[model samples]
Target: MLVVRVVPVGRARLVGAAVRRRLVPALTGSAPTASILTTPARCNSQLAADAHRRRHKNVITGPDAVALRLHRGHLVVQHPRWPVDDAFFSLAWLRDHCRCRHCYDNSTFQRKTDVRQLSSVGNPLHFNVNSTGTVLEIIWHDGHQSEYSMRWLWENSYVGARHREQRQSRLWQRCLWDGRRTSAEDLTSVVYDSFMTTEEGVRRLMKGFLTHGAAVVTGVAPTPAATQAVVERVGVVQHTMFGGVWEFTADGRHADTAYGRDELLPHTDGTYYSEPPGVQVFHCLAHHGHGGETTLVDGFAALNSLHQADPAAYELLSRVPCAGEYRDPSRRLHMVGDGPVIAHRAGAEPTPDSLLRLRFNPYDRAAARRGEPAEVEAFYGAYGRLTELLWDARRRLRLKLRPGTVILIDNWRVLHGRASFTGRRHMCGAYMARSDVLSRARSVGLLI
Candidate 1:
């Protein structure tokens, strides 16, 4: 009779040794045995065929491991690799690469590095089935080893492969003053005459909105009454203590002193409201005043900068939930939500067409009111970082709104602020609900 035995080597040698120590001595009759030797026919071609089929089915190929044997989508692994099988690889790894400023630092946009540029040292870059044939371990060329359950590798591999695409699609342009001269014509062409009341005009306007978060409408009467009339036709206007009906004036008020400063930081208005207005309409009744240049920033651009500079920070912010608050002697509101400073609706990819939102306010007293010091500290950390990005000159679009102009913005997507005024200034501003705008678009058959 011919006998053959398979043995594991290297790290697997111990298992091989143990198996041989127990079985070989018994088979050779040195140890007492209960049964006698069987006939040669007992180990027939059928048995060999069955064994061969099982072995062939068990081997894994390509970047995947063999233990993760999938037959018609069924997971057949009895055991999985370490760290690789843990959910950390799937969740933490991706979160660490989130392309939002809350998770990254936007100010370092130009310094951001690409993940594909990472160096792969001598780590075993592939997975191999262990000697026991029950699990797989990823071998790095550097001699580092990580075991992953077959299912875990499969799931994470899918996500890991998708990371680059997600990152690229979410990448946005950073609007900066390049020191290069921009012609007034270019600026006017980019921002003005973007809104339309006609079918083709509406199409162009929507397309512009998708490309730029805000656009200017020319040929509209520059008066406050004219601006308010347009706003009312599209949606209900949001009125606030800082509100006015016509070309109203904006000076720093004691209650909300942000607008009073000569230089204003980039920020979204109505952040304190539970459901802040989603769009803002600003009409220039007069621009004879000095400074007070209206600045608009693409929040997506700022977010992309952060994602490039500090991925770890970006991940932390995106994973953590935050509370935004607004309070005064007369009114108070609080909002608790989970999202990055820049985020799209869940299950959707972020794009220029995606709805973008930002939350920035320094005067949140929710933590003190609720007596949560840790939460407050975390919120402040995120807020302080975001503030730094807001004032970054490179990410802002500075413009002076001339009389006879109306600007419409997706408030959630663009952060608007002024560049301080030294003389008499007049402007009219109102909020248009997002629901109403979409409804208006649909009513006019602009959107299906």
Candidate 2:
């Protein structure tokens, strides 16, 4: 990749300073000599320069230079020394992305001027690569000065196979885990206080939760705010219908079974919403109950097993759409969402990577049927097979949570339930949006 540094307009006098030692004069018939930019930090040391090139797999090197020329109203961008991925940017695009302080906001990193504001762009006045081979200087058709890194352009080039391969390597790939794969390993745990206090500890917490689908945070206070605090450390607090954070206390109600004492089936929460919560957290405030042990299963892993056992069944479930709804007559709230038992990106061909996302919630399903009689029959057959594979002895995990113990789950990947309960059990928890988790992960290089 090319490294770039922009010199201020006033610093133009120093342009020849770098060319004296590093660059030889190059001209295409009376054009001013191409000036070279010098960046000591990136170009001074031989070891650092080698390391930079190695990071990019030697796509661009210190000796590489951007060769600019105007030919038939199209700007030709070439690098004779490297030329790993030559490209041409239209004058329209370059004018739009001018990074000058006046045209773009450095603090917010937002473009203040729109490309539409320019009435016309004819041709560039001049262009050249600076001495150190890091920055590309351009004086555009509209007299707007700009600088860019040759490496950045090469890395982002859409025409090059190297750029595509490099990007795919960094994409977040999911690993399906089941009772057999996860086994006796805890998936590793991090203390809540340490995770809240240090960056390294927080990264470890993220690694455990994101990589394994769920993680236990020990020694968290058995309070509602503590659960909120733990989730807020990684992202913004996600508010939902249940409020910012809520507490469930087995209220012994007859209507709302969630607040009563019974077995909660292995299912995802809030399938009724268009965008379900990405993550769910529960901090055990009090768990004096004997049979309310939490049952956890990896839904994706179960699907993989079902596919291996019966591909026809998996295909049926993937094709039949199921309705998920929430109705509260007294509160006057009813929301519904419809999708297949195994959700996949619409219009995308089926594959292992395309199976990255799915949803299953037998309990929350509304009283609605899709497809014809034969298709409905086929769907249930596949659904039953999937359910059987999920509930098998080797597929489920049963754990009894204690007070001060916290559980964080990737709601999209894992299904959680509670066994039958006898005594009082109070749990305080909250939700987190998917965008927050993804943005935070990408920020710290966890996802890519």
Candidate 3:
């Protein structure tokens, strides 16, 4: 094996043609791992390939390691400065991902190269790392040349250190909290004017919201228009059958229990939708009677507890698809959706690190054939266990929603409910798309 060390881009020395040819390994019968070429069943194809590269034991390292090389039909790279995997990228993948102006249009976010047309042009006539070691130049047999910056490659490489950091950062941003770790007083809050007018206020709110899955803006003018304004400030209003920025009082204005004067258990909204809203806003305009307090529960915290207490139950919830629906014959509306209560991250399986979102709304669930007798029993048992944790007093934060205060909860991560009230309670709020929520989080530098 040819050994070489990586230096700072500015300090890297050019090694002419001799070094380049030597980096291309000889025909030693060694081949890329099978795991790298074939995706496993029920796995994200890209992630599965990445996982293999990340776990490869023959990682190029050491003081004399060849940081960049061509082996068998793959480009292997290892940056000494970071403790990441030895990335083995196939020539085909590299050609398809070329971001040159000819292959990609930067201005329009459009791709000029069609992946389907790259099969005949995957062969690289020659490949070279520039003297600065910051750019990789590849000349294809088809007379096309592509250049990729080392930084860009690292960012896009699934096995790179940056990729690991990004995934871990998202997981770390979520700090699970319960009644013990947080309280009504400890729930994050910001001044309404500051939140509406300043970036600093938005940053504080977003940080808190990302960390705890909930936040409050105090002093919001307790009106439907004012509440709508606050919702729009964070993201575009997600319109549903309920309309944008809806107002509801203690009357049968809607078919759901929310329109009545009854206590609602901790649950997420829009379980019936294929893609549920990311955030739910609530601003109480008036409450004439008593016993109408908003309840907040961190679904993740409950999930963590369940995972530790009963792995089997947690696994069941992560695998079984629960059917949810919203029906109203009078209004001619009947929406239906289904998914695992504990949704895994995209392309991931039922692992702790894969837990991405939660969908828990017992009231809105539609009847379904839950499989075999044993499976049905297990599903219900797990469902009941999770519900118990969600209802635990020690895991809940109850607070009275008052005028001039707007509360926003991550419907994907937090469960919310209301206490039974006596007289009358009027409120206005709207739903926000999950993408917009993450977009704001990314804009404020809370997420990458």
Candidate 4:
């Protein structure tokens, strides 16, 4: 009888689909004809017992004794704690993923091993854990050796990958907030000098921006150039038809009501673009007016509130597509876009992290094509409820922008508007690409 067995190393489980399909046929040639006995890996309880018997290490015994067996071309790993089906890893996979100095380049963080040549490396003839149980040593059929830390192996295992994914999902979850919960004082505010001079200040700015969907920098030089500088520091300028850095007054320079004194409702910009800007910067260079207060509504917080109050309405908004268009005949500019009022990340359910963008701009919104009367009624009913929440004064954070105060908003998450003004109010601001803002945030460790 040809028997092959070794003591189990650690609590490794979860063989991914790809590894199972590719390695199983390559390893076994066909199903096994002989019986194979295998033991589950040492779980925490077993590790504790092992610790107690460390004085007589390598003397594993009892029902939970560590052991490995070859059934197909896979290393089946059982876990006593789970009492589930065995997990597996291929001998070829083990060899290809060896992180030794020869197979990997730590300096560049690249693999040196040629995966195409893995077939010639031969199978693992024998494998065992070190006395400390921290390392797994394998002697290959071709006399080559490989060693991998138990910690690394566990992390790469199916259970480990799932754990990592969950942790990341939690980290990426947005901290949704409304005006009642978040006030001007609650927001992260930095002085212009500190924000411009210190890396820590920038990191703090990004962290707050990601956490609250908005932040403020005070005491910035009250000039267009200064505002442009501030925007550049955070991210690259996202050029639009308006220009890279745009300044507008209540003059008839453009066609939009933004050039007039009429009050602008709470809405996100670029509803007519497929991919809207992520961040919007506003620096009131001069506001010698009476009622040009800026209104910021946390769209995520509002949606969450809606979800709690009326889940069906929230679902309606998320499921229905709303069309938007922008047309400037003078400039021969016409753009059209359409998407759900609420959007989610690809391949993910509507979790806080996966709720990617909010496309709510009633100004640019176009009439939907005729639909079933019930569907239209449902859509309008949901849209009306959402609008009421947005228009709620208590839920709005109104800021009377003055010279030297700059507000940076996550355009995709927060809605912005302006109160009708009486006198001169010139504001200079720019848009930043979503990728650029997120890249800046990730560079400062705000997100993974």
What are the TM-scores, per candidate, against the unseen true structure? 0.51, 0.73, 0.82, 0.70
lDDT of 4 by residue, 366-427 (tens): 77964456789899999999999987878888788889999999999999999998989989
Per-residue lDDT for 329-438 in model 3, tens only? 99999999888899887787776656788999999999975655669988989999999999987888889999999998999999999989998788999999989988
Q: What is the lDDT of candidate 3?
A: 0.76
Error of 4 at 364 (Å): 0.6
lDDT of 2 by residue, 1-448 (tens): 2334443323232222111112222221222234444322121233234333443232223443443444434445655433354466665666666678978898998997776765476555556565544556777645678876655545544434455555545653456776655642566578887878887777776777776678787888888888788888888778866678888888843234677778887888778877778888887798775788887888888887777888888887777778888777766778888877776656666544456456778777887666777777777788888888767767777777787777888888788888888878888888888788778776666753
Worst 10-residue lDDT window for candidate 1 reads 13-22
lDDT of each: 0.49, 0.66, 0.76, 0.73
Candidate 4 deviant stretches above 4 angstroms: 1-174, 351-353, 370-374
Give candidate 1's error at residue 389 in angstroms. 2.8
- After superposing candidate 1, which stretches have Cα over 4 Å from the reference? 1-197, 239-247, 250-254, 258-261, 330-343, 348-355, 363-382, 441-448
Q: Which prediction has the highest TM-score against the true structure?
A: 3
Candidate 1 shows a clash count of 18
Q: After superposition, how far is residue 155 of candidate 3 from its true place, in Å?
A: 1.7
